[model samples]
Target: MIKVDNLSFSFPQKELFNNISFTLEEAQHCAFIGTSGSGKSTLIDILMDPERYLFDGKLEMDPDCTIGYVSQFSELDNTKETTVFEYIGEPFIKLQNEIQSICTEMETSTDIEPLLEKYQFALDALDAIGGDDFESNIHKQLNVANLMKRRDSKVADLSGGEFKLIQVMKEMLNRPDILIMDEPDVFLDFENLNALKKLIHSYKGILLVVTHNRYLLNHCFNKIIHLENREIQEFDGRYIEYNFSLLQTKMELQELAVAEQEEMERNDTIINNLRVIATYNSDASRGRALKARVRFQERLEARRIKAPFVEIKQPNISFGVDNEMEDAIVVSVHHYSVGFDELLLDNVNFEIKSTDKVAIIGANGTGKTTLLRDIFKNNHASIEINADVKVAYLSQLQGEMLKDANTILEEFIDAGFKTYDEIGLYLFNYGFEGETLSQKIESLSGGEKNLLQLAKVSASKANVLLLDEPTSHLDTYTQLALEKAIEKFKGAILMVSHDFYSVVNGMDYVLIIDDKTIRKMTLPKFRQMIYDSHFDKDYLETEQKKKSVEMKIELALKNTDFELAKGLVEELEELIKWL
Candidate 1:
């Protein structure tokens, strides 16, 4: 258990939090929710005692408590030659040494022998924690993060998502009483996300998580703590309740602000009238009038006016001519196979017709993006295609494309767009206006760059669009706006995405790729396939029984029945083995 009392923090140019207070009891799970740049990460950093930050508060914890933190970014030594088993087992190695020391210091007895048995017991525990299958777990994490298959590969060969998952798995293996994870679900696929949820549910500790994923937050968080306007506020219940409560609070604040402004205006008018009359009256009357005016000013200053909340505006994309083409195949992949060593995609054949919206779906690392790139390359290679079939490609991190540019307008001009007015209009539609449009591209954030890229694509006269993970960095509202835009587009679209909600809502056709093959299906059929594949009768029954047993054991342990708890633990172990 831990408590933070009257905590305040600020950076050089901005105040992050002021007089924030919160508590995390034993086994409690809390989530920090806020918009981007609201200082969630800074608060976490202060709690974790990271250098280069200042803290002005009291953080009280149980003297024996141990903390384990998983950062958003992972730092792995590329040259260490450490296998996954050794990597996760490193934490237990220290425990094993301590156990050995205790055994050596104690006299020989039955108790000593039982206690000494813990060294070997710890080894078995490590294996049961998946140490023996550590390599497999690492592969699973990497694959779920969409990294290529490279079991013996160095960490340097991994992408940002891959490294982040590896760091998370490492922290989980430590089994600390206080776990702080920052955005664990950011790069994971559905399968791995479920695995992480199961693991967190099974954990017996205090969990403080920071994430933007609504699904994970809704499922795992028991309470939400929001940081806004240099203050912290707590909301009870799941994400849905918290969101609703937040909206209600914002509306109330806005109403109060309107009332305060009206009062201030009324006071200003009275003060003005008093001043006008006092000028023609005696000195005593003038002095009283000036005093009244000062009091009114003080009252106005005392009124707590909430700062206006700025909402990011959605883009208005107008699709040009809806000239449906019967023979226009925007993209075609014929007998295509791609891999680093082994085949990831094989004999993949697909064709995109004009006005068709196709969603490429697969388990992570199944070469969805590779397939898109192949299609783009093939389209570029074709010489017989018409000149009017203009294509625009949006990569996963499209912002990186503008790193060298001085300004967004300059980048747009360099990208061969004609007019600044047209570019400004497009930027405004994507939530960038006036000063933002003139901002240097090198100084823009990831989300800002993403908006700029979308604006550029919308301004282009391209009829065929290729988007890879377009919605990954976007918020829920922006994603919905993009879905609407895609629906309005008259051109063909080839997109690869893992966001299930967007896939279900926006995609017209689904292409499932696996083991170097592609299978085409309608959206309805794809949903059914995924559901039926994951929730077969046998698996459902097993999962139900597993949950029942876990609940029973938890209830028994709550009553301080040690013998029953020990027995239940053993039974649970056996059940896990069976599973």
Candidate 2:
């Protein structure tokens, strides 16, 4: 259990949290969420090591609690040459190795009693970590993550997403009392994402996960801790219920705001009348009345509603084309194959028309990003891009498009922005302010870096866009904005995405990469396949109905129809139970 009281933290440039307090108790799975650059990860850091920060807060942890953590930006060192099984079994392996060494010492030394005691201690340590069937347990965790095939593979050889799941497996198998994972779902393909959901659900200990994946958000957490507007809002319920509570608050706040506006307008009219009377007659009573009316208006203004969560800013992302391609195929890949040690994709072929928006989707390490990179490079013998097409590429690796050594302002200038003023104005739409422009790119949060990448891509003015996992680090609001922008892009788009909503809501069709070959699937078939593979058809159907009713309730609330809204809330409460 962890508890924080009256916490306030800030960087030199800005305040990140103000008077925020929340308690994470036993058996609670809390989703930590907020807008981009809102200090979710920073808070995690403070919790992990309170001494590293200088802040005003009371952070308490139970003395008996054991904690495990998985950071957002973690990587497997390729130079170490560790395999997946060995990595997950590290604790057990160390203990087992010590036990073997103690037994060997017993064979050579006259102090056999001490060596026997040491061997027993090592065996006890191994048992303490549930290492009785360590190898099989490792396999079980890998199977849970859908990475059983990679059990024998080198950890360095796995893709970024796969390695991330391995980290999760390692941490979860350690069986700490409390596990804190920061954005663990980032870069995960759909199946791996599902695997993460299962792992979180199956975890018995306390959990505090920072994630923006809606599927995980909807399915995994039992509690919600939202950090926004320099404050924390904690809810003791599921994410869906928390969201409904937010919507209800928004509805009531909107009504209060409207009434407040009307009252202010009427008070303004009264003040104007009193002013007129005071101006016409030099009566002391008239002047006093006008002063009273003005004071009333000021009080009303102070009481006006500015609801949180309802007014969160979303990045303004719009993709544009530099030149039209005259209705031709903008990109074409034929007989393409790419891999290092093996053929991940063999004789794959796909094409994107001048205005087509297609998604490239597959399991992790199945060559989705590789294929996109090949198309963008246009160097392979089988890859052909139209001569007239101008291409812009967004890499999943943010470093590919950004220089860590440069400031935000410098990066844009290097990217061809004319002046600081222009860059400032442009970056403002993407949520970077004038002061933040001077910060080094390396200092930004993962979501902030992704926003910078999107801002760069939008300004490229290319007829062909090759985006690899563009929504990986973005928050939900930013992700929705990007989806809208992708929907309206007037050019060829070959997007590699694992977001089901992004693909279903924006793309025209999907190019499936399976079994080392590429094929196209219509949107309808893709939707059905997703429902079949990841979710229950009945559950999704109920979810759809729930969404429809929620919208109706919003409409009712907007119209100030309390009776209708009340009825819909009852209906939704019943639906929530089923979900």
Candidate 3:
């Protein structure tokens, strides 16, 4: 069991957690969930680095038991240029090194028995962690994860989803006593996500996940460790039940708090009335009544309830409609093809009529972003569109595009937005203010840059949108705001996204990119296709590029580095010009 008692932690400005306590026993799976900056990540980091953080706590953990971690956005240390096989067999690699050292020691002395004992211990350790048959077990694990096919691939070159899968596989290869996953749902598509779910379910070790995905929280975890009001709240069951209980608790609190507030207000009013009457009467006997009323007001104030603030500030997003255009098909692609050195799709045909919301989805590196770029580049190509179709592209490369640009004030002014205060007010609505409005564009974090880019794109008066991974880095509340903003938009949107929650509920139709073919399928059809392993090996295959220029373009645009974007966009135009 991993026991935590009487834990409290503080930063320079605020006390993050107070008297927090929890435990994870064998066979118990729980999750730590809270609002943004509530120390969910900090708590996990402290767990991994017990020697570093100084806090008041009593932690009881078995010395021999091993702990494994999967970071939310952390990448593997690929400094050694590791391969998939080597990365997955890292534990065995360490074991073999130890065994070799013991054998070398045997060569110098007449201690054969000791060497043999050491060797046997190492082998037994491996068997105990994974399985008895070493080679067979390795093959089975790798095969199940689909890493065997890419066994020789460099670990550094792996896609985010692929890297996450391999990371999980490595932990599973040497089953730790406790496994902690921090936001495992971030970059995963439908295919990789299901595989992870299966692996988690089948693992015998205790599991703890920190995620904002409600679907994942409900399906994977059995317990909820909620961080709220600087206190740790524990629930014995899954999220749905805990949510219902939390709702009831809040309702009870609201009733008590409201009653307290009402009583205090009534008492204050009585005092005011007594003072007014005493002033008018000018009688010495009125002093007693005034004093009594003041005493009652003091008593009410002394017993006032301090109610918890339950509201989380979400971004206020509004995408106004450019009704200048007539209602007609905004975008039409016919007999078009898109790819680089490798072909991803061929003779694809699709139409965005009026204000359709189309989601482009496929496995990782399967031309979703490329398809968006293709549609965007066709502004100068043969792709037909209504004369009034004003297309605004939100590339993943927007950050790179705007990286070297001037301050937010300059960018806003350059974009034709008049007045610094006007831009400040506009940005303030999206969570930026006075000094922040004058801050340099590059100074913002990746997520902040993403939000700013989102604000810029949604602010456009364009009648059509071509967005790629716009919600990948946004917080849940911001994502909800974006969804509402999209709902408010009267323009056509063709977005490339792996955010299943947003795509599943927000988009009207899905454009599935598979096997060099494009199919406009219903949302249910696309979900069913990815949910089950119905397709063969050759079907969902992808050829990942050395570096995705598309992402660079999006980032550059966000960074306002238009000089870099121009060349990159031109190169992108040249490469995908082939059938």
Candidate 4:
């Protein structure tokens, strides 16, 4: 459990938040929701003591409780060769050593036999907590984070998603009583998001998660704490309830300010009349009335003014005319296989018609990105032909494109875009303004980087767009705005996104890339497929049977029934092979 009392923080010229007070009881999950630059990440940094931002607060915690924090970026030391298991298990090594020391000290005493037994008991307790199933826990964490296959891969070779997941796994393995996560769902797909939800549901600890994904917040959190106008307020329901509460509060405050202004005007008129009467009659009574009127004026001046209203603005994009189509193909892949020696797509044949809006969907690592890359490479190879189409690819980890040496405005210019005034106007549409446009790209957050990528793509005037996980870090409002832009685009679109809402609500056709093949379906049919696939009894029954066999073997081993466990394992192996 944790509590914050009288917390206030301010920057050089502005207060970020003030008088913030809240209590997070054990096992309670809470989410922080706000617009960009609204101090969501700043609050997390203050809690975690990362940047020592100015603050006056008392953060009280249980004496023995531990806190684990996961950042948006993973900063593992790449110079050292470390395995996934070692990385996860590193947290417990200190406890393991302490247990060893206790045992050694008790071993040399004859009169300390009971003490030795106590130390043995303590060691067993620690092992039971995390040591016994450490390996399995690592696997489960990696699986939940969608980094299972990359366990043996080096940290340097991981995709952005895999790296972020590893950070999550490392924090989970620490088994702290309180977990503070910033943008925990940055690169996760649907399957991994569900897995993370289930894991959080099962956790018996406190979670303070900051994320822009509404689905994750709606599914995982019961409390929503909003930061607005340099203050914090807690809502006791889901994200929708919190959002409605904020709207109502804002409306009430606006009405109150109006009434207050009217009252002030009325008081001013009464004071003016009293002053005129006192001017007409100079006496003790007149002096007393004047003093009383001045007191009212002072009281009026002491009242705090309501904070100004600020609304988050989104990017406005108007795509140009669609390019003319010719006899030559825009995109074609023939017998293409891509991956690290493993074929993700095999003998795949696909073509993109001019001005086609294609949605790529699959489980994580099923070659959606590979297909996009193939298209871009194919298009680049045919650039000499007049019929060849221009392709622009937007990656999920667009943050990597930002350089410290260039401001966002400079980066736009460096990317060969003309018209500084036009670029500044475009950036303003995407929420960048004045000082923000002058800020280095490296100073921007993940969400800001995503906006920059959108700006760059829009300015390029490319005939084809290849976007991979474009909505991964975007908030719902921004995602909807981007979806609108995509819908208005007249050129060819080949996008790979795991945001199911975007696919179902935006794209015309869904392309399921799996089992080394690309299967195309319409958005309506794909939604039906998702529905039927989940609710079908026969399918559920088959999956249940498979899980049943695995559970039986696990139970047998736990009970020390070797013969039965071996038989069950063999049967499970046979079933797996047949499948």
Comparing 1 and 4 on lDDT, the stronger one: 4
Better of 2 and 3 by lDDT: 2
lDDT of 2 by residue, 237-354 (tens): 8888888788778767877787888888999999888877777799998888888888888888887887677778888999987796667887778888888889899988777899
Least accurate 10 contiguous residues by lDDT in model 2: 247-256
For model 1 the TM-score comes to 0.66
**In order, what is each prediction's RMSD in angstroms?**
12.6, 2.3, 13.2, 14.5
Q: Estimate each model's TM-score.
A: 0.66, 0.94, 0.76, 0.72
* Backbone Cα, N, C clashes tallied per candidate: 1, 0, 29, 0
Checking candidate 1 for backbone clashes, the offending pairs are: 346-516
lDDT of 1 by residue, 109-132 (tens): 556676667657767666545555
- 109-218 per-residue lDDT for model 3 (tens digits): 78688788888998788677654454565667667766678787888767778889888877777778889988776667777776676667767778888776645665
Residue 165 of model 2, lDDT score: 87
Ranking by lDDT: 2, 3, 4, 1
Residues 162-236 of candidate 4: C-alpha lDDT, one tens digit per residue: 566667777767678889888877667666666667667766678888888856775678888777667777777
Ranking by TM-score: 2, 3, 4, 1
- CA lDDT, candidate 2, residue 176: 86
Top-lDDT candidate index: 2
The TM-score between candidate 4 and the true structure equals: 0.72
The parts of candidate 1 lying over 4 Å away from their true place are 1-21, 54-66, 75-81, 94-166, 228-231, 246-327, 378-386, 397-400, 404-449, 531-579
Predicted structure 1: lDDT = 0.66
How much is 99 displaced in model 1, in angstroms? 7.6
Candidates 2 and 4 compared by TM-score, better number: 2
